[model samples]
Target: MSRVTPTTSRSIGQHTHDYAYYRTVLANHALPAAFIDLDHFAMNLERLRQRAGNLPIRLVTKSVRSVEMIRRILAAGSFMQGLLCYSAGEAAWLASQGFDDIVVAYPSVEPTDIRAVATQLRYGRAITLMVDSIEQVMKISRIAQAEDVVIPLAIDLDMSSAFPFIHFGVHRSPIHDETTALILARKIAEQPGVALQGLMGYEGQIAGLMDDVPGEPVKSAVIRHLKKKSIVEVNARRQAVVDALRKDGHTLRFVNGGGTGSFESTRQDRSVTELAAGSGLYAPTLFDHYRAFKVLPAAGFALPVTRVPKAGVVTCSGGGYIASGPMGKNRLPLPWLPAGCRLLANEAAGEVQTPVQHALSTSPATGDPILFRHAKAGELCERFNELLLIQDGQIIDTVRTYRGEGKSFF
Candidate 1:
């Protein structure tokens, strides 16, 4: 894929939404259907390209579980080069879809999944497995050797920082320093069926945690400080591991780093060959609080009002699409369109029905469209079969998500 520099530098939330337009355009569509604003998606593509600078991005598949949408985004720009799939099985699935340069971002010890990746490798597909321990390396090597194929592997580097009381990043890989990384690398070299291809360091503290939140000044300020500190520590640890591995004569094909939130800092590391991001494309509510960049809200789902309980209140059928993480109010789906609807505190969003409070000034009759944005990206796709592609106030086309294709890997 050839890189095309986006001639831009700015942040935009993309669309000017109107509830009447959505209700009218999607009059005949289903009650609860997921949709993507094509114009906003295109603008987000430009925004991500600008954030990445010249570095190509390996698209993270968990944030975007739609094969059709992934194809569209990859075809949209050359800056998007490969897939950073979340599972061993997902890597095999993508390889079957003709996607190459894939690195399964998480390690798997499942023999069936490893053999699936080997099958793709036998077909000349590039599917690299992720390993952080000697056991994972041996498991993959045993499966690949049994299949009679030499599989490429990438080491998952733990980029978390240890503070006084708090451990900064997600507990992903056990390989925190150069010593553990070299230990894993030596194990990979000893295996005849698996070759070391690259290293991946995901700074989740800097990348996934929200720093510029509204209303909580003290928390946000503290988060910003920790993020700033974590960036320096992340770069140093990643650099040390890369330098030591290279000095030991290990040829790494790529050093993957960062996510949507850490693009600015992660791009500065010369040791990193590419960045990984996908949630920015969909622009879920979790990504809305970042100070540096604001991507457009590209995807959302709309629910049809079932009944009008009061003048300022209405109930919608089936909305309980909460996000994964620690249980909090932020995990709930955000009431989006009509500009005045609010989720009731007592019930919140429910499995069968959701009661919402609206402004008395605006009346919402029965059968009106009540739109909502998910707390996270791609998880919304798991709820719906297809996403209605919207552009210029019209439903252009309907595309299938990974769930729509009857393929769910997680």
Candidate 2:
């Protein structure tokens, strides 16, 4: 079934989703529950489409772990194509649930994991595995041949640019240059039971890092400058590899790049066929620092205030949904809503209890729901089994997360 887009030119976060707004909407709900504001979610969907321009977007499954949510986004428009699955086993599971055209984002050498994906190929599922090395390609090829099914594969390129004192990107794939990428792609073209389906170059520095952070003009400027330089090198390197492959008479099914943060820049590369984005759908706190586009905090958890520790402090029950990354303050969840509540410095979010400091005027009373946005996206789903779907100021429905569906692949 087709879905409707529910958004307008009006501001999404400035005045729409205030504390009082959700309080009345979720007054009857339980505490420590995750919820999606369908209105804002629709706006984000529109925002993603607009930013992507003509490029198709492959949803990153790691950022959105809910089956229902994924279905809704895919139904949002034809611009949404396929999924960049995090695990091979999970990709096969999604295939079992009737989703196709899945590409596993990471390479797994386990024979059992490869077989799980090969099993899906019998049904003609276009499930492509990611490989960055000849060994990875051979491992998958051996398993694919054993399964008696042809498996497709996408090559992951390391888009990081190295400088004197810094590595300006995340440490991901090891295939860093056109020669290295061609060597691997050539291996795939000659290998048995494995075909070169596409290439994916995740520019983590441009996609994952924030450049316009508040109160850090110098730092932000430095990041922006570094990103500009990295983009030129990244685009050049990616083009070189794509050109080399096509010159070798190999056809590419697709060329995927970037995250939501880098769409504006990534889309400009002629070598790119599509871009990947998912965190923008939910817009966690970590996504707040991007300059190109601002997405609303459409998804968050409401923790019921359990106690008033002081005149200006309220403690909520169970919120420690910290995102997986290098441990630091940025990985901590942001205390949203109530307008003035902030997590304590000494004790930010705790497993059993999270104490928040707030202005007296905006202080939350006991039993009141304290709204908080997670640092990351899909990881939040791992905490809550279900998400309360809110729309038109009412609880429209409740959707099960991947965890709720008895599927935890990580």
Least lDDT summed over 10 consecutive residues: which range in candidate 1?
1-10
lDDT of 1 at 368: 82
Model 2 lDDT tens row, 13-96 = 444578988999989888879999888888888888888989999999999898888898898889999999999989999998
Per-residue alpha-carbon lDDT of model 1 for 1-410, expressed as tens digits?
A: 22222324453544556788778887888788899987777777788888899999999999999887778778866789999998889889889999998999998898888899999999999999999999888888888888999999999999999999999889999999999999889889998899999999999999998888999889999999998998998899899999999998899999999999999999878899999999998899999998888877888998889999877899999999999999999999988888888999999999999999998876777888898999999899999999898877888888888889998886
For each candidate in turn, the TM-score is 0.96, 0.97
Misplaced by over 4 Å in model 2 are 1-14
- Cα misplacement distance, residue 56 of candidate 2 (Å): 0.6
Clashing pairs in 2: none
